[model samples]
Target chain A: MDLLIQIIFGLLTALIIGAAMMVVTVRNIIHAALWLIASFFGVAALYLLLEAEFIAVVQVLVYIGAISILILFAIMLTRHISGEGERLLTRHWWAAAVVALGLFGAVLLPTLAGNAWGIPLPTGPAGTPEPLSGVEELGRGFVSEFLLHFEVAGVLLTVALIGAIVIAFEERSRRRRVLTLAEEHTLNQRQKASAERAAAAADMAD
Target chain B: MRDVIEQIINTTFGWGWPGWAISLIGYLIVAAILFLIAPFQMLFLTLFERRAIARMQDRVGPNRVGPEGAWQPLADGVKIFTKEDIVPDSADRWVHLIAPCVVVAPTMFMFAVVPWGPGMVPVDMNIGLLFFFAISSVSAVGLMMAGWASNNKFALIGAMRAVAQMVSYEIPAVLSLLSIVLITGSLSLVDLIAYQGGLFISSSDVAGVPDLGLGWFIFTPVGFLAFIAFFIAALAEGERTPFDIPEADSEIVAGYMTEYSGMKFGLFYLAQYVLNFLLCAITSVIFFGGWQGPGVGWLYAQAITPANPGGGWIFNVLAGALGVFYFLAKTYGFFFVMVWIRGAYPRLRIDQLMDFGWKFLIPLTLVNIFGATIWVALTKWGAAEGLAIVEGWSPMLRWAVAFVVTLALNLGAYLFLARIFAESQAERLRVDDEVLERLTNVA
Candidate 1:
């Protein structure tokens, strides 16, 4: 059983690394996003191997299900810019490589020496693991022991939501499209006149 | 099925067969069965939808193809298979080729956690409900792939709308299910069903209750709201009428599937019906009890399991048949409702779809979660159970209080949210008209 698990883990790790590499190296932006989903799926598989089924499902739910699709949507929406045969990487490829490698070393060096690198199952698969008792434990942990952190995170997300709405929200009037060139010209003129009026009002008040 | 197979293997063969091997064989059988079931369901549903909708329209459906269009889907399969598989010259050929498979694969994965009868689940995953929804969401990416890769304007537009509609409606779907999860306190589909075993009241809410298999969540206020929200969201997810903006046939020319022909189109059609079937099944599982009906609980209790080996094989057959019958009845009933709605309602516009999902359903489900919490507290919590206020109340009284409170709360939330949604929508349209009038210099 141990050997079987190790084999699966190794395969998943290989998939993760390969997909991550492809995510950066792939020329097609959409393909890169798809590779990112593969990498996310590999991580989810690892979480399942750890018997953290809830986390594994969440990883897939949030990453492959939601985030990857969002990324794909963003990429597809900008298909005019991210057209085929375009170079995704910038000119400073070496700089990015150096930073990436440096970060990898900084993170990987300690992980290679630590207990996490080559550990057997901490507990044999005998008793029902508490975390795997379904979503209740996750909820309890969030609401009780990690209550402070949970509230902080909730507040943080709320702030982010409000911030996103503020930043991304467009004025209602601007969404309407003028049909003819004359109508468009008139709308622009009206906008300029309003801008001038507001400027003048500000100057007079000052 | 796995247990029966393993038992046969253990008895017939020596104990030499490894545990993993037996398990693998069992899973393989389940997968083969599920794959077969998906296509079969697709075939049945296509005919079912056509016949039901046709009847609603005062017309006799396709009865020519082998006894009431029973074999129509087979004819469709042959036709689609023989049709030339055309890929547009400008299309991303690889993505186009893989998109149908991608769409179909998740629907297949969905069968893993669905419980058809007692002990009929392929996988009893701890987070089964989460797994089901998560796997379902993966298909949205495939739909986007179909749209983006097709290189056709209609296809891309269809794909974009598909993804947008899916992602938006998913919020309400999950939120509504979350309320049920909060009440049941379990994400497992079987657990959810087991919780609904009393006569007209959940067994979990009232102790020592007889398991008559009549207790369904839909009878409760929380469940009713959830059922409404979820079915609507399911409509959006399955791209049924009223939420079929993504694939509005008249508008976008088959939407994301425009570029595909032959088995590829057949695959999308198969994926769709399979998804609809699963969604309907899950809706029944969550709101209407999936396999739980009159006598099902009692029958299953007497069925032959390891704990109840004295029970007869006859009981097993009876229980399994009854459970599956109830499950299929509820599921097909939902599908019939889908057909009914399709016949009754016109498709929603894309903007209207988004507005309904985000503005109305999301808020309603969110409020329903609060209602669920209140119900749980009132019914389950006590002084002995760490509550001060409900210390003296009897269990029956507490249940009644919870029911009344939640009913009032849910009704208020629904009416409040509906009014706000309608007003906001009207306001939004008014703004749109104002802007349009200014720009066009015409009414």
Candidate 2:
């Protein structure tokens, strides 16, 4: 049973790492996003294995459902750059590789090698089994223990949303600027042609 | 079924087999059941949609293929199977291939938490509702992948519209369910259905009420509003007509499905109908008293089980049959409504869909949530539970007060939001006319 458990864990770990590698390596941006989703699913499965059903579902909901779709949306909305023969790597690829290796060595090596490595929650008596929590504990914690943090996070999200709106409306304000250009600028024949182009752009914006 | 499977496996194998092996067998059995049910559900839903829509359109739909055209979907399935599975030359081959699997998988996973009859859940998950919706959302990626991989402009557009519509509408749908969740204090669909086992007033709301199986959430004003919002959102989620901008046939040439052919297209069709069936089933479960109609509770109580092995197996079969009958009746009724709406209404534009979802439905559901809170306070809470005023009131009186308060709030919110939406739309059009007139005059 223990060996079987270990085998499942090893498989999930391999899946996660392999998928993550594919996410980075896939030349097609859409394919890369899909690979990233596989990584997310692997992480979610890991969470499920750890008895965090709520977190696992949330992970899938947010990452696979929303984030991955958003990435694909972004890929589609932008210029079609994911076709064959286009190099995915930058000129500083080797530098990135070296940095990644160094970072992994610096962070992962010590922690992985350390004795007291796992998450340290409040432990009960030596033989007493720990209780696994789901939505109930999380909800209670959000309302009671972590109430301020929860509210703060919510407020932060609201502010961020407002900030996004303001930034988006800033572009709308530019359309008004284009409308006012005719009143503000004095034009020669050459300048008039440029002004007409501006007018046409504004009209198109409308 | 899972528990039964486990018991059977354990009994046959004696004590030698470990718990995990039994559990694995149980899981496989449950998964197999769900997987099997999904395709059949898809088949029936497709045939049902066609026939139902045909009747709505005043046509005798598909009377040829075996007994009121029950075998129509089967025939269609065979045809789809035989057809050549075509991938566009420009398509990203792998994503195109895997998209159908990804799309189909979530709908299958959703069946895990869906209680078909009493003690008939594949997995009675604690956070079943959340798990179901979250799993459902994962399919958006599949839809997007299909669109993007197709390398067709129409497909991409369709995919974008579908994803946006789904994500936007999910807020109202989820928010509407929040009130129910708060009311019941449980996200389990089984528990939710179990809560509604009494006459008019739920057993959860008023203890000792006879389980007439009439206490549906839709009977309450808050739940009614939530039901309205949820059904609309469900329509959007299922991509039924009026919210079917994702695959508006005339506009985008079959939308994201333009490039897909044969079994690949068939897979999408299967996924869609199955999804619609689940949505309708869930709606009935959450809002209507699913599998909780007359005689079900009593039969279930007398049925053979771990608690009462001496109880007759006769009651078990009777209970199962009656429960499933009621559940399917309610579910099919909702599906008929979907078909009715599809026949009645034309598809909305993408912008209109967004506006309906974000502007109207979201605010309505949000206010309904507030009303739901108020309802919870009046119906559930007392001085003991921290609401001091409603302490000494009778359950009936409290229920009445909750009904009045929530009704007023929800009705007022609906009117106000409708006014606001109308005014904003009118205002935008007015400004557009003014701007247009000014531009034309200047030219």
Candidate 3:
């Protein structure tokens, strides 16, 4: 079982790294978004390997399902979807490399030195190993123990949503709305009726 | 399944197969069976929909292929297979080739968590419902890829509408299911079914109740509302007619599928019908009690379970057959309703679709969730949960009160929302007319 898990972990790691690289190097903006989704899926699989099923499913649902689709929509709506002829590297590439290397080292050094690796599973009263994360326990913690944090996070998200709507809201008076075919027909009919009435009034005057 | 296989191999045959090997074989067999079942369902559903819809339109549908046109899908499959595969001149070759597989694979994976019969789930994951929906959303990416890779304007428009509709409706769909999850307090499909095993109320809700296999969630007001919303959302998600704007034949020439032909088009068709089947199956499973009908539950109790290993194996077979019968009946019943809807209603405009999903269905489901919470508090809670008023009441009396309260609340909310929504729509129309009149006068 351990061997199987290790093998899966190794494969997932490779997939994550490969997809991440593709995200940066892929010429098409849409393809880069696709690669990003693949990278997100790999992370979700890693979560599953760690026995965090709830988190894994949420990662797929929120990131891959919602966020990546949003990103793709934005990319598609833009002018250059294929990103052909775009420069792969900016002029200050070395500066970016320095920051990237420093961030990677900062993340890796702690993990390499940390003593918390390979911790044993917590046991229940019956001496059986408990799941690393259970859905029910997580729910209980959110509502009871972490109630304030949960509410704050929810409020923050709601605020962000409202802010987005406000920014995107167009003024009704200033907006130029396109009429549907039915509406256009109604407008045309009204104009033709008024025109005929004007002609009839002029004829009566004559 | 692993247990059964181990018993046969290690005990009956005295082969002493290892546990992991037995489990692996069991999973492989289950996966193979599911793969077979998925495509067969797609084939049967295509024929079923055509025949049913044709009957609605007062016409005979392909009755010459086989008896009642049973082999029609097979003939169609052969035609599609023989047709030349075509890729557009400027299409992205690799993405175009891979998109169909991406779309079809998730529908197959969804078979993993669906409970076909009692004790017949493939994986029975703790988060089965969540896993199902999550995997389903992955197909949206595939649709986008298909549209973009095709390099066709109509295909791109169709894909955009498809993704937008799916993303919007999924909110209401998941929210409606959330109410059920809140009431049941579990996401496992099996647990959801097990909770519905009494007369009108669940056996889990009230003890000592008879298991007549009639404890469907639709009997309750909250469940009824959720079922209505979820079914509507399911129609949108499956791209069935009335919500099939994504592929409106009159509009954008088959949507994202406009650029594909031959086997590729066939794959898209298969994915669609398979998805529709799954949506129906899940609807039945969550609301109508999958595999939980008369005589099946009683027989299953007497079968060769771990608790009663000495029981006859005949009961197991009997229970499984009856359970599967009930499940399929409910599922096909839903598919028929989908066809009936397609025949009855014209396709909704895109704006109307969005308005219905966001303004009407989402609010209705949000209120339903509140009712579900109240039901839980009344039926399950006592002084320990700070509901001291319900502490002295009997379970049946509390249940009655909860049902009555929730029914009133839900019905009232529905009527109020409908009135407001109608008024808002009418007001918008009036405003549009006024604007048109003003513009006419200016001219």
Candidate 4:
């Protein structure tokens, strides 16, 4: 059973990491968004395996629900310019890849050395293992122990609210001003045309 | 029976068939169920809704199906299936094909988390609530896909409105639940229910005769307001009645479903009802104290007989079955209410819906959470202080105060929402006027 879990975890981790990379590296922004969703799903599955039900759900909610759609909408709005061409890679692709590779090696080489690296593994998984009872224990901890952090999250949300309002209001105003100006321009043109018609009628009468 | 036969096969063969083999079996099972039971359920629900709404409207409905319209949905299904599977020449073939799948799959996946009974669930994930939210949200992507893929102007516009509505509403939905989770402290649906077992009810001491009351999350005021918040969110999520702007049949001509047909269209239609059912079920579980009953233990005990003396398993099964029935009944009740509202209320404009979600639901939910947390903490403190005196009075008083506060806030929120809705509608009218003028000039 342990071995089965291990294999599943290993496969999941690889898939998750690969998908994470693909999200950034993919040429098509839409495809990239889809890849990011795959990565999020992979992470959610990992959270499930770890028995972090709430976190997993939050991950899926934020990433897939809010973030992915936001990205999709952004992509759609910008589609006229970017089109379908997967031009996600910046000018320094090789540099980025080399840096990534170096960072991977730095972590992987020592990890491959295993015991020689001298990092201690506890009798159980490091950090507070998520309670098997799920939300009940998590709730208790959140309310009593991490109450501070939980409250901070509320503050963060407030900030988000303020930011959303500002942006929305700004956008609304900009659209309104432009629309009013355009209306005025059209009205002016129509008036000019009528005046010209009146002058032509007078000429005909004369 | 066939179920016994399948059980034998499953036990004997085990679940370790090759991935493809297992998947093939699962697929076949799902397809069979969908092909067989889905149509029946869809038909029944349709008839049920029609009859229910008709009663609400004080009229007899669908009495011709099969002695009071029993077979109406079946006839409807048959008609839909035999209808031509029209594909617009201008539509993108692949995306169009996949759109219904996207819409349908998420709704279907939501059932996996719902506990119909102890072992009756398909996939009992710990993050079941989250899973439901995640999967349901993806339906918007499907809507967008359907809209974009169709290449029809109406479909595209409808899809945009849908995507916007869903995205805006999603936050308030999560935030509303976040408040509940704060009090309950767990994400597991089972755990959430368990927390509510005792807290769901209190003895009302009217003349010293302890009145055993309804066990529900909505009993408390914050819980009650939260229930309303959750209900509105669920309604919008399911695209019911006032919130059913996505498929505003009168306006967009089936909205994003403009180009879909055949089995694919069937999938989307099935998903719509399934999602509707799920939103109701989920609401029941979260706010109505799922599976809690009076003398549930006694009910289980009564299930055991002389022939089944050591039938602890039987009792377990009975209890689970009872829970399933209760859950389903509550869900159906909610669905009936939704249908009733649909028959009664006018559809909301897209801007109105968004304003309701963001300007109203979001702010109210946040305030509800703030008030709830403080209220819970204060009540707990009171219980601690008046440990001896507050023993009998604790649940009742706590609940009463919570109930009053929640009701007040809900009313306030509604008024606030009305104002916002009015303002946004006026703004939208202004925009519409500009657009109309431009169109007239261009013409």
Candidate 5:
């Protein structure tokens, strides 16, 4: 079982890294978004391998489902649909590389230096015989131990949502809403009727 | 399944098969069965929808292929297989080729978590409900890929509308299910079914209730509202008519499927019908009693389950047969309702569809969730949880009060929302008419 898990983990790690590379290297923005989604899926699979099924499913649900689609929509609406002839890099590429490398090392060095590289899995408290990360336990902890944090995060998200709507909202007087088919028909009919009435008055005067 | 395989190999044959080997064989067999079942269900659903819709339109469907057109899908399949697969000249070759598989694969994966009968789930993951929705959403990415790869404006528009509709409706769909989850307090599909084993009131909600296998969640007001919202959302998700704006034939020719032909188009068709079938199956399972009809509970109790290994194997077959029968009947019944709806209602315009989903269904489901919480408190909580008012009441009485309160609350909310929504729509039309009059006068 351990061998199988390790093999799977190794494959997933490679997939994640490959997909992440593709996300940056891919010329087409849509293809890059697709690659990013693949990377997200790989990370979700890693979460599953760690027995964090809830988190794994949420990662798929929120990131791949919502965020990736949003990104695709943004790309499609804002940029060229085919995404051809796009430049891959700018003049400051070396600066970006330096910053990226620095961040990666900052994240990696502490774990590499402070802890043993290889270790067996930790067991739960004696006699429990199960992991303490069940969905029910997580829910209880959220409401009890992490209630304040959860609420604050929720409030922050709500604020962001409202801010977005406010930014998007247009005043009724200033907005140029498109006419529906029915409204257009009514306008056309009224124009035709008034034209006929004006022609009739001219005939009577003649 | 592993237990049955192990029993046969190790106990009966004295082969002493390894545990992992048994598990591997079991999963493989189950997977093979599900794969077979998914496509067959898709084939039958296509024929079923055609025939039912034809009957609604006062015409007989294609009955010449086989008895009542049973083999029509097979005939169609042969035609699709023989046709030339067409990809637009400017289309992305790889993405176009891979799009159909991406769309179809998630629907096949969804079969893993659905409970066909008692003790008859594939994985039975603790996060089965979440797993189902998460996997379903992955197909949206496939849809976007298909639209983008085709290099066609209509396909792109169709895909955009499809993704937008799916993302919007999913909120109401998941929120409605969240209420059920709140009430049942479990994400496992099997646990959800098990909770619905009583008379009108679920035994889980009220103790000492009779096990008639009729305590479907739809009996409760919250469940009814959720069922309506979820089923509507499901229609949007499945692209069923009236909500099939993505592929509205009058507007866009086959939507994202415009450039697809031959087996690729057939694959899209298969995925769609299969998704529709799964949606109906889930609706029946969650709102109606899935595999939970009279005689099923009794027979399953006597079956050769792990809890009762000494029981007769014949009871296992009988129970499974009866359970599957009930489940399919409810599912097919829902599918018929889907067809009926397609025949009755005109397709909604895009803006109207969005307005209905975001304004009507989402709010309705949200209120249903609150009602669900109240039902839980009334039926389950006690003085220890600060529900001192309901502490002295009997379970049945409490159940009745909860039912009445929730019913009133839900019904009131529905009527109020409907009026407000109608008035708002009318007001918007009036404003449009006023603007049109002013513009016409000036012209």
Candidate 6:
């Protein structure tokens, strides 16, 4: 049973890592986003295997739902650069392939050889065990054991939110300057054209 | 339940090699069978939703496939498979290709945690309920990926809104479940069901009964409120009507799935229907008594005992079969309710949705939890003090109380709305008549 679990976990992890790598390597931004999602799913499954169900759900909700969509929105807004063209990347394909293969070989060898040095496996059950780490358990644990860290995380979130607002305000001022500059140039051009037309009319009358 | 499966398999096939290997093989075989049937089940669910909604709207839906368009999904599947797979010229190629796969995988993974029948679950963990929540939430990522990868502005916007909506609504869903968890004092889905039984009566009383029947969670007022919240949240989770702004057909043209075609599109469609089934199943387990029918326990014992003359693989198979049927019925009933609502109501605006979740649902659910906890605490304290506050009530009286409470609440709600809107009683009555006429097919 342990071996089977190990194998399943190993396979799932490999899929996740491979997908994550593909997300960066793939030419298409959309495809890269998709692969990243696959990686998130791999991590979620790992969380389930570890019986950290709440964390797994949180991982999915935050990373997959929020981050991926934000990335997509950014991609959409940058319409001029987002379009696909053949050969966006230019690299020595053979050398890159060889390096990738060599890296995989190096990692695989140690994983295969280090089997004997395995950590102590969970003895009770494959999934969640008795005195289950439920929401209530986590809640109690939060107030007792990890209260400081939880409070710090909350404080960090607030700081980040405030920083975002300040940055946004700065960006707003910068955008106003750029907009006024463009408006001034257009207005000057229009006035010059009108002056030229008036002078031509006077010369015709003379 | 999983232990029972291990024991049964070990006793019968103990002479084999390692017990673990045999169990692994057994589980894989079961998974294989379920995988084969899952697609068909998804297709049927779609048809059922379509037909039920059509009936609610007094229209005939998809009557061209097979008998009553039963084979429509199959035909649709074939069409999707044969269609051209478009790789958007401007889209992120890798993310686009991986998006549907991402969506499908989490949905499939969720099924692994769901128990449809007695001793039929693939994995019966102590954190089964948590497992369900975790796996179900992962689909949001897939959806987001799909939206992002599409490279369509509409898709991107829709995905963002959907993510926000799902995340906010998830709070109420979890809180509602938390209330139930408090009552049951367990996270395991099976244990929670057992606890509900133990709460209402003694073990001896249960033993005297046929299936060790429990008072269903829906019977209590607090439980009923939780059930409503769960149902609404689930509809939002599944991107169903009223909460389906993320995929509003007239506005966004299928939202995140806009750029998808061929089998890729089919996968998303398949996932949506399966998700509907999954949500219904979860609601049934959490809110309703799962597979808790009359004489079910007795039949289970009779089918499993060695001394019983008729006991064999056949009886065991029958038990499993019945279990599956009961589970399917419960899931379908919930799905039908969703379909009915979809036909009856209009979609909500995104802002309205966010407000509904954070403003109304969260506070309402918190109130429900407080009420349930106080009720439980009072009952326990009373028992300890030898003053019975609630022992038993006549069924008729209980039903009457329910009716009077509901009527009074409805009247209060109506009066409040009238006051707030500054509408006269005559105008309010007119609006009520119009709604009633619409419901009764007179308008």
Residue-pair clashes per prediction, in order, are: 0, 0, 0, 8, 0, 14
Off by over 4 Å in 6: A1-206, B1-15, B198-214, B301-319, B379-443
lDDT of 4 by residue, B35-106 (tens): 464446566787899898888889999998688888787787788889888889988787788788878878
Question: Best-fitting candidate, measured by DockQ?
Answer: 5
Q: What is the lDDT of candidate 5?
A: 0.92
TM-score of chain A of each: 0.70, 0.71, 0.80, 0.73, 0.81, 0.62
Query: What DockQ number belongs to candidate 5?
Result: 0.72
How high is each candidate's TM-score? 0.91, 0.91, 0.95, 0.76, 0.95, 0.69
lDDT of 3 at B277: 96
lDDT measured at residue B98 in model 3 versus the true structure, 0 to 100: 91
CAPRI verdict on model 4? acceptable
Better of 1 and 4 by DockQ: 1
Poorest lDDT segment (10 consecutive residues) of candidate 2 chain A: A178-187
Computed on C-alpha atoms, the DockQ of candidate 1 is 0.36
Residue B180, candidate 6: how far off, in angstroms?
0.8
Error of 3 at A116 (Å): 12
Two-chain complex of model 3, DockQ on C-alpha atoms against the true structure? 0.63
Interface RMSD of every candidate? 5.5, 7.3, 1.6, 5.8, 1.4, 16.0
For lDDT, the strongest prediction is: 3
Please write out the lDDT profile of model 2 over residues B1-443, one tens digit for every residue: 54566566667755656777778887887788778888898888888888888888889999898988878888999999999988999998988999899998899888889998988887789999999899999889889989888989999889999999888988999999999998988889989998998898887887878888889999999999999999999999999998889898887898888999999999899899999999999999999988989899899899987888888889999999999999999999999899999999987867678888889999999999899899889988878878899988988889989999999999999999999999998986686556544554454
Better of 1 and 3 by lDDT: 3
Candidate 5 chain B — worst ten consecutive residues by lDDT sum? Answer: B428-437
**lDDT (tens digit, per residue) of candidate 3 on B17-114:** 77888999999999999889888888999999999999999999889988988899999999999999999999999989998988998999999999
Candidate 5 chain A has its poorest 10 consecutive residues by lDDT at A119-128
Every candidate's DockQ is: 0.36, 0.36, 0.63, 0.31, 0.72, 0.17
